[model samples]
Target: MKNVSADAINALKAQCRGEVLLRDDAGYEAARQIWNGMFDRLPGIIVRCVGTGDVIKAVNFGRDHELLISVKGGGHNSAGNAVCDDGLMIDLSLMRRVNVDPKKKTLRVDGGALLGDMDDESQLYGLAVSGGGIISHTGVGGLTLGGGFGWISRKHGLAIDNLISAEVVTSDGKLLTASAGENPELFWGLRGGGGNFGIVTSFVFKCVAIGPEVYSGLIVKKFEDAKEYIKFHRDYVRTLPDDMTVWMVVRHAPPLPFLPNEVHGKMVVVVPFVWLGNEAEGKAFIKPIQEATPSHGEAFGMNPWVGWQSGFDGLVGHGARNYWKSHHIKGLSDDCIDKIIAFGDTMPSPECEIFIPHMEGAPSHVPADETAFSYRETPFVLNIHTRWQNPSDDKRCIAWARDFHAATEPFAKGVYVNFLSEEGEGRVKEAYTEAVWERLVQVKQKYDPQNLFRMNQNIKP
Candidate 1:
């Protein structure tokens, strides 16, 4: 990190339309804080960028001074790459703005905007964007760049498939547009390579006509039956239509109104699904899972898309200490099923759980080399979502997740970049195939030779 002089800092502050806070400033603490509480790094300076102009100014200042830059786009990465210790943090949370063009079947979202923000805008016109995260607060930038998958991903495609164009500011301080016909290679890299190439200012994604109301909710079963249900699901779900997507989870049961009082705080297997088409058809889609396991609780019917998207918000809200380990698996092999049940039965915390998102429809058809998300062919992704509220329980929670993840190593195809932590370069390499990694490196060298944007799942030049 370069020595940031007072005069240079003042110059940067004057150039932006937003606030710039030093480490000692009043709002600095809040500005530097990210989604996960486990990472406790303090930035030397925090710039609350309000728009593209602010982002440009901040990037130029950091580049000129060779300052270690950490960019924050809603700050929701589990790896805590949004902010870094002793660097200049470019905070884009305040730049959230969503524009919906219903007739064009497109939605343009600001780089810093959250999924909830985009949903609120697009849903107003009875339009929907595919491939948003389950949590509404997840930023459009990181999620989309890393091949975002949501309830509608199986039907529509990953967020990158819907991405028409991206407005970006490169390391050279020039703004550029990347799409199929413009900066095509950069476009491919951005789709799944993450925020390494540049600072994405805005993204225009192709939208699909989806439900203002659809069938979506959770069904709970005993934790002990997780392996059996998973075995049934691994085969049954492959037969389901693309309009319906199911993600299986095993964790301590929440005290939702549907669950029995005796089940509250007890371990359970949760099967949650969302159907993009008709309500009746959606209910029928998930019927097999309910029949496979003796359900302790079930809730399935027509519900607003906004409600379902934000459904998991309370459970994994910000400020919790979260450490996650994820793997793209071939299927629910016998060994994988056994390990999932083994880990699910002994969750360290109520919030700690396993998430197996099955995305094997439209997203998988895209050629692996076509985009930076090389693990597209994978059918099941296991995420050891380790979360806790207490500081003391961090070790136990993280250890359990690590052990579970390591135990399933033999069954993994590769790692998903989005669910990756600040793991070593070896693990990061696993996120991409050698061919894709080489291409990404070439793109990184062309756009960011100095590696200015190294905060994400970095593809170092």
Candidate 2:
């Protein structure tokens, strides 16, 4: 990192429209905090960007000073690349703004906006974009850049599938628009290339008519029955329609109202799903899962779409030491199901979970080579979400996740970029195919050849 002079800092403060904070400033401490508590870094300077102008100035300043720069947009990534030590941090938390065009069924969201920010505004008109994830506080920018998916993804598509355009600021401080008609190559890269190319100031997404309410809920099965239930689930979801999505989670059960007191804190297989269609049809589709195995408890009915989006917020709340390992699997083999059950039995912390989300519907229908995201045909994504609060338990928690992930690696074909931690270059390559990786490298060479935006899962020029 370069030593920035006091004069230059003052000049930057005078020119920017937003707050500038140094280590000693009032909001500096708060500004440096991100979703994962595992990373505790101290950036030399933090710029709270309010708009595109501030982002341009900050990017230019960071480049001119030759400083290590990190960009923070909702700061929810598992890798914690949103903040860096001894360098410039461009904070975009203040730029959250969402504009919905009902007539066109599209929305333009600022880079800083959270998934909740977009959901709240769009749901008012009974419209939404796919791939915001289950957590509402997740950032729209990070999610979309890494091929986002969520409850509606099976019906609509991945977040990148809905992305229509983006306003980007390159390393040289030039603002440009990327879409199918303009800078088409950059647009393709932005769909799933992570944040290596540039800083997207805003994004325009094509929305689908989803809901103000939807049929969704959770079903908890006993750990004793997990082995059989998982095998059944693996085949059951394949028969369902795209309008319904069911994901499996193996973890110690939370004390929800519906579960028996004896089941609380016990390892269980929880199936959560969302259906875009009406209640009766949704119930008919979910009936098989309900009767698949003798469940310990279950909850299913109509729920507010926005409410369901943030339903798991409490379990995944920020400020926990989180380490994640993930893989893309075509199907859950018998051996894979056994490993998942075995890991769930020995979970280091109650917060730790093995998340297996069913994929392959609308997104899979798109050709693999059409965009930088190449794992379109993957039918399942397994995420080893290891979370704990105590620093002393870090080694145990991380090791559990790693061992579990390694045990299941043989069954996996690829991995999700968004679910990755600070794993090395080799692991990053697993997120893309050879052709897509080569194309992404070319785009990087054109827009950011010097690699100023190396804080993300980088594709080097």
lDDT of each: 0.89, 0.92
lDDT of 1 by residue, 1-461 (tens): 35788899888888888999997889998988889999899888888999898888989988888888898987999999999888889898998999888889899989999999998888898877888888998999999888899888898899999999999999998899999999999999999999998999999999988768888888898776777788888999888888878888888898989998999999988889887777667767777888998999998888888888888898888899999999999888898899888888788988887888898999988877778888888999999999989999978888998899899999998888999998988888999999999999999999999999988888889
What are the RMSDs of all candidates, in order? 1.1, 0.8
Residue lDDT tens for model 2, 1-461: 35689999999999999998999999999999999999999999999999999999999999999999899998999999999999999999998999999999999999999999999999988999898788999999899999999999998999999999999999999999999999999999999998888999999999989767899999998889888899999999988999999999999999999999999999999999999888999999888888888999999888889999888999999899999999998689999888888888889999988899999799999888778998899999999999999999999999998999999989999888988999988888999998999999999999999999999887888
**Clashing residue pair totals per candidate (backbone < 3 A):** 0, 0
Candidate 2: list runs displaced more than 4 Å: none
Sliding window of 10 residues with minimal summed lDDT for model 2: 1-10
Error of 1 at 213 (Å): 0.2
Which parts of model 1 have CA positions greater than 4 angstroms off?
Answer: none
**Which candidate number maximizes TM-score?**
2
